[model samples]
Target: MGTITTFQTTRRIVMGAGAIAKLGEEVRRLGGKRVMVVTDPGLAGTGLVDKVEDLLKRERIAFARFSDVEADPSYETAVRASEKVKEFKANVILGLGGGSAQDVAKVSSILATNTGGVSTMFGIDLVPKPGLKLILIPTTAGTGSEVTPIAILSDHHEKLKKGIVSQYLFPSVALLDPELTLGLPPSITVATGMDALIHAVEAYTSVNATPMTDMLAMQAITLVHGSIRTAFANGGDIEARSKMMEGSMLAGMAFANAGVTAVHAFAYPIGAEYHIPHGVANSIMLVPVMEFNMLGNIPKFANLAGMLGENVAGLSAREAALKAVEALRQLSKDLQVPARLSAFGVKDADIPGLAQGVMKVTRLLANNPRLLRLEDAERIYRCVL
Candidate 1:
């Protein structure tokens, strides 16, 4: 018998080239009087912050800004953002930028209404109360953090990445403006686009996958497969950018409901320990993890080959499955994604430690279609090493 599953997303999702123009009205509709805009220094420097500030000014909305968000945000970052939220007494929190900024805003918004730090709420569904009204805007085409009920924060003291998963983390709105992504460099475009691909593939092959999630994941896969290269090569191509952005959001919703498997399970550890960007870490582990998982679900992988636009008309399921793995490898190669862990400064001796760190994230591993034992985890890390 198939397991029943429930799909959930933000209350509203707005996407398009000029979608960001609706930000002020959306905040007003949410009954926000004072807004706290959480973002990062890089984005602040790029004048995107000025663009958002202008929108707020036009709407006559009172707003405060916090631009200290860091990549792969730390637990302390959440607390600091939360403190600023309280200081401004902001009734709404607007997260602007990529995954890290969105994560900081999500945690900070929740912590503003709840008790204790993000540490106390690690693991699944640990948030005890609803948070202030929150809206998320993604300037990059990855890490659908806008739609997911997940916030990943690094714990510096422990040298590990932890996630806070709860319905409370879902933003009130997910605003995706492809115009905002026009300036993304090719490398970031590749890394983030692949991250979305991983989300869709992992979710489709997850133990918790359902019909609805599969529908969403497959479309996301198709969209990403069709548009990633164009989007990477021509950052200003609005059509390509729009497709990637929508695909990323769908992938995010897919994984949020169906759960991610070993790829993400392994990524958290690598990202936290090495200070790698989350999307890049996922890109690094994606091919090896998919190769490991292929044998566990050949038919699904075969279908994936077709979704990824591989020529599999005359191939058997098993043959097509191999094509899917090859397709991922070729995509990564073409994108110039680092092919080995050594590229990230990880050594062979680090496999065991990475394995041990992965074991801490069984919440994700449990959803792997194949059971990833400790030995298997070590072996996967060693293969990539």
Candidate 2:
């Protein structure tokens, strides 16, 4: 028998339609009076920001809005946001957009409370205290940033993406309202759904997997496999959107506790270097990385195949694993996700540098079922290229 540790989800998750409407009530319940609403420019103009403000106004909760977040939010931006938190004297922070906005909000909250630059807190569990109370509302059904205890910020000057992982970073509340995702563009739908798929797959195959994590990861995989295409094909498909949102949140919970493996380790460098959206980068690398990792744990792959709706009965574990990779590849191709790094503007000559970056992501690489060294990472990058 293997040792299985209990998994932890620190956030109180409130989901379903009209969940956003309860944002004010949830904040009040948390005893927050002054709050800062963090969001990106696109969502700021979409009236979503106003809707949240209206809810707060009706509840008589004092709030300020900060809509300066950008895609691949940078360290400088986080610092700027932290200043806003201080200036507004916000007692709570509301993250209201996709991953970038959520990440910026989390980092800003940390910086506002902790006395240091954002760079000082990079890596796991470095923050000594919980920051401001945070309520995360994810408008996109991807990234799973709402529930994860990690936040990623880009360092443009360093040409790298760094993360801060701390249980303290977990939102006090995660408000998931699928209605907020209906207006997401089709391209974003495909990219983010693929990201959710990668999160579940990587978590399931992670060496640190526990029974609790496995259940969440498997359910997440099944949900994404069943509904991603429908959501991508029809943005207004509330049912599909709801499922994807749930899957994304579940994946975040699973991976935050159990960790992620090589796909994410590889995906991060691509995102940092190419400025590719995080989800798109994950989609591009997922199939190839999964194929590479399949030999490490055949039974896990077989189970994944079954979860992805492959008929694995009577098939050898190896065969079933291959089927899982094939299904993922087919899904990516069907959704128009870029198949190779080359498609995202990577040159063959750049594989060595990317491989080095992948190897440097030991936090994630350590969780891979199969140990990944520079040579293997290079080979995988070349294959994907």
RMSD of each: 1.1, 1.3
lDDT of 2 by residue, 189-235 (tens): 99888888888899999999888899999999989889999998898
Please report the candidate that would top lDDT against the real structure.
1
- Candidate 1 wrong stretches, greater than 4 Å: none
As for candidate 2, its clashing pairs are none
**Per-prediction TM-score to the true structure, in the order listed:** 0.98, 0.97
Candidate 1 TM-score, true structure as reference: 0.98
Tell how far residue 234 is off in model 1, in angstroms.
1.1
**Position 4, candidate 2: lDDT:** 52
Look at candidate 2 and tell me the lDDT of residue 205: 92
